[model samples]
Target: MADEVRQHMLECEARTWLRNGYNTPERIQELTLMIANRRGQVSAERLIEEMRRQWRRRSEWLN
Candidate 1:
């Protein structure tokens, strides 16, 4: 449960970064590495997925 909440928070942070123009691939990779170091590879992967989902949603909303 706690881990789920932490992952949710990480997803939210990733979404915010995407909304704020930190959508570069290099920046995303950097964030993934940081999360992997602090959390784990799985968490980092989750963050990447969340960022991708948010980016897709934003693109859809815009177009």
Candidate 2:
């Protein structure tokens, strides 16, 4: 059940990324490495905070 939900969520997120023209496998790999490398040195909260910051800036520019 959880796995099914996870798969659906991944699909939906991938669709969103594709629509935004940022659905490259290389970008995904870089993101994976960035998260993994920071696991011991940084927290998930901090990483999400940065993502939110960037997304907000992009949204502002788009609008």
Candidate 3:
């Protein structure tokens, strides 16, 4: 159940990156490391919240 939700959140994050043109190689690497480090420990809700906060802060730099 948790894994399923995590997979769905990952898919959504991928789509958001695609739509926003925000998935640079560096960002991908960061996300890869982040996921690898957090996998099976963090809840999907907490992960998504942190990702959203990061994105919000990052959008300023992106703009």
In terms of lDDT, the best-performing candidate is 1
TM-scores for all predictions: 0.67, 0.39, 0.37
Q: Pick the candidate with the highest TM-score.
A: 1
By TM-score, the better pick of 2 and 3 is 2
Q: lDDT tens digits, residues 25-46, model 3?
A: 6765565566657774344345
Q: Candidate 2's residue-wise lDDT over 1-63, tens digit each?
A: 998986556544444543465435576456546665867334433444444444555554443
lDDT of 1 by residue, 31-62 (tens): 88888999999978887888888787776544
State the lDDT at 53 in candidate 2: 49
List the candidates ranked by lDDT, beginning with the highest.
Answer: 1, 3, 2
Better of 1 and 2 by lDDT: 1
TM-score of 2: 0.39
TM-score-wise, the better of 1 and 2 is 1
Ranking by TM-score: 1, 2, 3
User: At residue 54, what lDDT does model 1 achieve?
Assistant: 74
Q: Candidate 1: deviation at residue 37, Å?
A: 0.5
